[model samples]
Target: MSEIQTVPESRRFLSALGPGLAGALSVTLIHEGARRVLSHPPRMDVLGKRSLKKGLRWFGVRPSHGRRLHRQALVGDIISNSLFYALVALGRPRRPYLRGVLLGTLAGVGAVLLPPFLGLGRSPRRAKRSTALLTVAWYLLGGLSAARATRTV
Candidate 1:
């Protein structure tokens, strides 16, 4: 009989990092590209900027302004999204699509519902139904990307 092998938590997280980053970058590329082409793309960047500024203030640091603020927000978004997607590493290696769906759904719902409570702004749903839905889909895409990238690593 063959014994199943289990990876250490730290190793799992480390192994997941590259895939997580790939997922995050994919989402950003898609989102930014859509923003350029679509007349009404999801403006999640606004929320990200607001959230980052608020976080910095809470930490007694001043936030940047103009293009610099936007750049900072983009970086922050990638790092955060990577960490969130990395949670999938805790699950079994098989059925990555299922794991992706679950993680993506959770993040999607939170993106639409949690902003107001967090003082970031109103929910994305309040702006436009299509945009809100697209926002969710974007995260879903990220999840799937991370899941697929895991196979290569």
Candidate 2:
């Protein structure tokens, strides 16, 4: 008789990490690279930076400025995005691309709409139309990357 073998929970989680990190990296790269060329770039990292600063202030910790702030914000963004994308491991959806689109849309909408409600101020939706669109588009790109990685990796 053959005994059944099950994968450990931690191993399952680790399996998702590679695809998740790939997606997060893609999103960051697309946004940062675009910032140099766009006259009115969507400032998602700025939003993250501001949120981080507020969190630090709440804890009475002094936040860094300029380049340091940017680095911290980018790190935070990547880590958070990685975890978010890693949720795919739980579902193991048959259609990963669709899952990617749905997940990305949800995140993009939240990014555009949640800021004002959270006292984070105006969202990308309040900015120029292009900014709003690009904000969503980059997220979609990340989702696609993650979904593709899920299939291949």
Candidate 3:
């Protein structure tokens, strides 16, 4: 009698990582494109640079624009996307579209309200409603993509 060996849950989760990354990159692309089309100032890269700058400041290192900025943004996307999809996968939503919408709505709400509260003083809420909608839509698309992608995993 031979017993079957199963892979660890962590290994299983690792299988889902690529999909999460794809979802994040896709969201960034969609979001940036919308922002450009709407003539809104680029915001995503700024978020990454802001965090990186704060971290570097503690080390007495000054951050700059261009490469460092882009790299940081990509890294942020990877971390955030991985986390989001991991949660979704673990939660095992019955309907991905519904789950995506719910998750996206929460993220959108945060994007709209948190910046100002964080002392960044950005007025997402006060800004034109369409801008907020665009942000939410982008996030929604990401969630939807991630959920669908993870279905294979």
Candidate 4:
């Protein structure tokens, strides 16, 4: 009789790490792009205000005046997508569009849930929404980066 071998869950989880890291890198790139787009002084101020309002609305809470919740959202976005990618890499089934959507949803939910639970600042709805948006954005960015890198080689 022949013996069969099975892959361990930890090994599968480790395999997923690269994709998760890739997702984070993609997000960082998009964030840099957004920042560049809003760099001009007048545009910067306008975007700042809009981002804060959006972040507040996203989490179903009011933002402190002059607070940069948008930036925090960007951070949360990276964290959430990275986690999803890591999960997927860990031998989880892939669903392409659905995966991105699920990741975004989780990111939004976590953003709203974590802060208050940890005795930090109030959960910002706008930031949650922004995190969700960033997840989708990172997915697109990751695909594009992969495609471009493949072409260059």
Candidate 5:
């Protein structure tokens, strides 16, 4: 008779947790790098007019647009974090990095669209800050849960 090998549930859970941590850390590093670049406040003319326009479009808006788009980006970051944590909680591991990027992008768009669509045209700074804080909190929670999962295995 052939024996059936069964993996322990704890091991399976921990394996899933590993990828989630990797994804979260990747996001945090990317975010910090982007912040560092922004802090330098690159000159508009140094990059040239055409390149500058392209960059603004890629980032989803012009510099003259104020912090509205920036706030959306922050909200997107929070949404991405939430998605990562939700995946971890479900023990699902498939394209974590890509998923993070997609979720982040969607969140950014949502932040831009939601307020104006709902006719709540106030500054988005407060909402952005709140979202960023929530993201950090979610990351902390995910880390703790992953740690516990590791210990169990």
Candidate 6:
């Protein structure tokens, strides 16, 4: 009985991964699209690279120049989304889709406010108005996608 249960549980965990990947990719696509239209500042890839570079610096490890920064950024972004929905999968939301919207809004707002508190960089309030709004929209969409993905599973 336990072996049978373990198989489905493992499968469920694997299934949850797709939604997370979708969510992350969706956010990236939307962000780029919005940037093209609205001219928002700070490419997410650059921000990811900066964050990763700073992290590596802390450990006395230096990253290579220019090349693979985008790849590194992509991997980091995907991992963050994966980890986030992994929690949702385990938490077993009664209404995953609805929960996703709520979570996304909270997360979007948190993202805007967190930089100063976390000391990552300047808050979006200092950024261009379009940039601030687009950033929040992308984050919200990511959450929606993640939730929708899981629901399909």
- Off-target runs (Cα >4 Å) in candidate 4 are 39-84, 92-97, 112-153
How would you encode candidate 3's per-residue C-alpha lDDT over 1-153 as one tens digit per residue?
Answer: 999997788986787676666667777777666656667643655555666776677799877679867777668766886677555454554775677667767776677778766655575556677767767777777777777876776
Checking candidate 2 for backbone clashes, the offending pairs are none
Per-residue alpha-carbon lDDT of candidate 5 for residues 48-131, written as tens digits (9 for 90 to 100): 233334556779975433355444444454444444543543433434444444444543444434544544443233446654
What is every candidate's alpha-carbon RMSD to the true fold? 1.9, 1.5, 3.0, 9.3, 14.3, 3.1
In model 4, pairs of residues that clash are 16-89, 54-126, 55-126, 55-127, 58-125, 58-126, 59-124, 59-125, 59-126, 60-125
Give the better candidate number (3 or 5) by lDDT. Answer: 3
- Across residues 1-153, which tens digit of lDDT does each residue of candidate 6 receive? 354434476777777778877777787777656656655553566666777888888899987557687678778877886766554444565777766677667666776677667656776646877666667777778878888777776
Tens-digit per-residue lDDT, 1-153, candidate 4:
998897787876665555666656664666566657643211222333455566677899886553366566555555655656565343234343445445545543554455556444445433555644453444555544432322222
Error of 4 at 97 (Å): 4.7
Position 53, candidate 4: lDDT: 66
Give the Cα-based TM-score of candidate 2 against the true structure: 0.92
- Cα error of candidate 2 at position 42, Å: 0.9
Colliding pairs, model 6: none
Candidate 3 TM-score, C-alpha based: 0.78
- The C-alpha TM-scores of every prediction are 0.92, 0.92, 0.78, 0.46, 0.33, 0.79
Q: Return the clash pairs for model 3, or none.
A: none
Model 5 Cα displacement at 94 (Å)?
8.6
lDDT of 2 at 58: 93
Better of 3 and 6 by lDDT: 6
Q: Which tens-of-lDDT digit does each residue in 14-127 have in candidate 2?
A: 988877888899989988998898999888888989999988999999999999999999999999999887765446558778878887777777888888887777898887
Error of 3 at 22 (Å): 2.4
Better of 1 and 2 by lDDT: 1
Candidate 6 similarity to native, TM-score: 0.79
Assess candidate 3 and give its lDDT.
0.68
